[model samples]
Target: MVIELYTYPVGFIFTFFSILSLFRLKISLTIKFGIVGNILYCLSILTSIPMMYYFTRDTPLLLLLLSRISLLIINLIYLHKLRLKKREITLEDESEIRKTILNLGTKFMRLEVREISEKCGFDRDSIIGVLKKMIINEEIYADFFQTTNTVSFDQQTNIDEIDRLMTVYKDWEKDHYEKET
Candidate 1:
């Protein structure tokens, strides 16, 4: 009788902390480790329900229902927050990919797309997609040849474009500076 009295609250507290800890370790589970990380996270959440319910069964019906319902609600809210964080993390990843492509694109006069894909640990299509976006955004000075499956960089052209952009920026700054002040 004495042990049973303490077990419910103790177990509930443990499960609560377990869930909270999982939420705290968001980056390691959801972003860095990928699918396996997600699986472990979901399992921790799913397992917590049964653990809480088992402890609550001998208590009043109201307490049991409240514990289960509250746990589910908390899980839902945390999942929603995790989804938002995942979106932010994904955007950061795309930016990193863009930077990597720019660095690789500059290292050679002409390089194979497959080679960059291998170095970046992403698929060939993903690499091509990032490269296309970079080209569209004028973030890289390169010609992407889909027919030949290669990218060719011209540093001189890039330098000229940079100089032109600087001149345009300076003119814009001069025009806007006086008005804003």
Candidate 2:
């Protein structure tokens, strides 16, 4: 009785949970595949647990060929997908993503690399490294550094400066509104 309880039913439960786990968020894909592979492997151990049943010596060899082949293929495919997903830093080649990220920091004339990293969900090292490149590329600039090491964006370049820029920005907005209409 205990043996039977631990065999097909336990195997089936493992498979069921594995399938269900795919729907769960925040769990890594690698773990899901491992669960499925483990269950299929345990289930495959059933040789003759069913009374008078002969999986290996069965005359037709139906279970041996069909079940094993299908399970093996599925396991290999899932495992391969897991391996692909587990590769670190999959977005390193996508410059567009980096461009969008760069825009966040760019909005601030000057912000601490740490501040941008925290806000944008990027590491500090990556933020600073990319920021240095952006600076070199003339995509961004630091202010008030004619003789100092400080890099900061003055909130108000000048009272007059803000008013002047706001007027220009408002004019651009009106132009866009007219064009859209």
Candidate 3:
């Protein structure tokens, strides 16, 4: 009974951290937290197995095992996704994505994220990540539509400002390259 009672609280604490980790901006931290949570969860499930079988005789052992197994599988899938996302976005990739979005934003007021992803040769997640960073940095004025997976650029955004920023950015890149070589 004691083990059964403590199992939930411990699991809940780790699970909370795992879920909270998703909100973290850094993917590395999220993955670390998720891994810890999974390990703790596995231990909890193993420890609780005897109590579960003994205390709750009405519940079939197979059913309990299957349920726990499914939960573990789900956690494994989540970790897999985290690993995929751990692929860091390089500076060159960021710059290319930024340039593509800016160029497209100039031509159209709104565009599907899929369209931008295809044009830039980056995955949808990468495009979304850059778009979010740009939005946060005040480099772009836009709103995301979840239903359609599209971004609508605000009319108030100055096209001239976009052009100026791009020009200055390209100049800096050119100078930096020249210095390096």
Q: Rank the models by TM-score, top first.
A: 3, 1, 2
What overall lDDT goes with each candidate model?
Answer: 0.64, 0.53, 0.76
Q: Lowest-lDDT window of 10 residues in candidate 1? A: 30-39
Q: List candidate 3 stretches off by more than 4 Å.
A: 1-75, 78-87, 163-181
Where does candidate 1 clash, by residue pair? none
Best by lDDT: 3
Greater-TM-score candidate between 2 and 3: 3
lDDT (Cα, tens digit) per residue for candidate 2, span 1-181 = 3554566566566666666666774244534544555555445454333532543446434455366557657766766675555432335533533564445533665555556555666554454455455556645444423233234643343334546778999999999999999
Measured with C-alpha atoms, the lDDT of residue 94 in candidate 3 is 91
Show the colliding residue pairs in model 2.
Answer: none
lDDT of 2 at 109: 56
Q: What TM-scores do the predictions have? A: 0.38, 0.35, 0.47
- Models sorted by lDDT, best on top: 3, 1, 2
